[model samples]
Target: MIDLFHCFGAKPAHRVDTSLAAEMLRASGCRHLAVNTHTIDQVTAGDDLPVGYDTATLGSVMALVGEELALSPVLNINHPTSAAEAVKRTRQAAQLTGIRVIKLEVLDPGFKLSVNAEVVEAARELTADGFEVWPLITPDARTFAQCVELGSTMVRVMGSPIGARRGIEPQHLEPMGEMLVDSPVPVMLDGGIGSTADVEQAFALGFQSVLVNSCLFADGTDPVTALAGFRATVDRVASGTPAAH
Candidate 1:
């Protein structure tokens, strides 16, 4: 069955209560979670956090232990400066947290969509270090191939601009499908994924996983309820309960 991972604050935004979020994660049965650079500060501060909490940053994507309630934050590293600096920072985080899955978001200082040689090099370095490098890149077939060529562990794509809260539209899926048809590595659907319909569509197309960010972390939203809904959908689809599809 295809599993899903969640990403929160994939871009710079307000702070979140890591303790509360961790509670929701366990209650909702969410096994994987990611927090971008912006959200990292909240969990890593080590000041006044609830007892029994340990801070560990995985490259922007963390594997949560559901029953134990251990929150391993998956870090979404945004490349705000030179490639070397980005790589260095990631390596340091990995060393400190023992995070294996590193997501590299090649965003320039202006936050514009950027994919270049330096960005690719940073990914290569992370991969060579044995970290599972997942690049959050624009949804382009060529760029997908480029990431795979560099030996990325996973290739994450966003059809709409990141944080746009748009789903995988047909027009975007056609090319995304073509890109994954023969990919040796797994591909993920990022951005614009907020509902069961989106999950079904992603499952049908060949996405190994889908990312949920703003939809789960938005104001006034109940993340536990939302994540439960998504998990139910996964169960239904995996069971071949035709009604769900």
Candidate 2:
């Protein structure tokens, strides 16, 4: 059965803010959270930004998240320009940190098909080393197929532009969902899921999970409440209860 994951990026927000995102998910009764290390500055500075003791710092905080919040933090090794440094961090994240999922945002903006192919090759090397890699990318079936071949544990499909709340554009998803149904590996939907209906749509399409972010926090809707609604909706869809289909 697929599950919901509360998304949290532990940026410079006060410890309180970071804690709040988790607390909100806990209150809403989620068993998992997709924690992130990717921040705007980190993306902008590329690989030279100081990561320092932040690894231990993040790990300590996640370890504190009791049994209820099953944390699967996604460590972003996004900088393609510094593949070596990114790879080092990935090894560190897998070995030292509480991170189990290595979310490789390897595809930098303006990446051509060939560049994406190269990223897949690099990711293949990582997966060969026993790391469960989850490449954060578009919902392209070809890419999904390549990722599966490269040994990714799962694939993440961006539902909209990064954090935009366009609400899982049905047109964009049609092809992605088609791929999910055909692909052997599980697919996780990310970006732009604004409501319970969106969750329902993803589950019905055969996706194993959805990565919801901005919409839950930015809107006045409480994360817990939103989670409850999503959980209920996903359950119904999974059970073949059918949402008036």
Q: Write the per-residue lDDT of candidate 2 for residues 9-128, one digit (tens) a residue.
A: 322321234455555556555554443433323433222222221332343445556444664455655444334544666765555454556766554453211234555765777787
Among all candidates shown, the one with the greatest lDDT: 1
| lDDT (Cα, 0-100) at 46 in candidate 1 | 20
Taking every candidate in turn, the Cα RMSD to the unseen true structure, in Å, is 4.8, 5.6
Predicted structure 1: clash tally? 8
Tell me the lDDT of candidate 2.
Answer: 0.59
- Local error of candidate 2 at residue 29 (angstroms): 4.4
Q: Pick the candidate with the highest TM-score.
A: 1
Candidate 1's C-alpha lDDT? 0.63
lDDT per residue as tens, model 1, 1-245: 36767643443342345455565566455565553343333445322222112342332112334336545545557645566766876765565556677777766665645555556778878778877788877667777788898888788877565555567755776778778797798888776676778888787788877777667656657766777777777677777787522
The true-structure Cα RMSD of candidate 2 reads 5.6
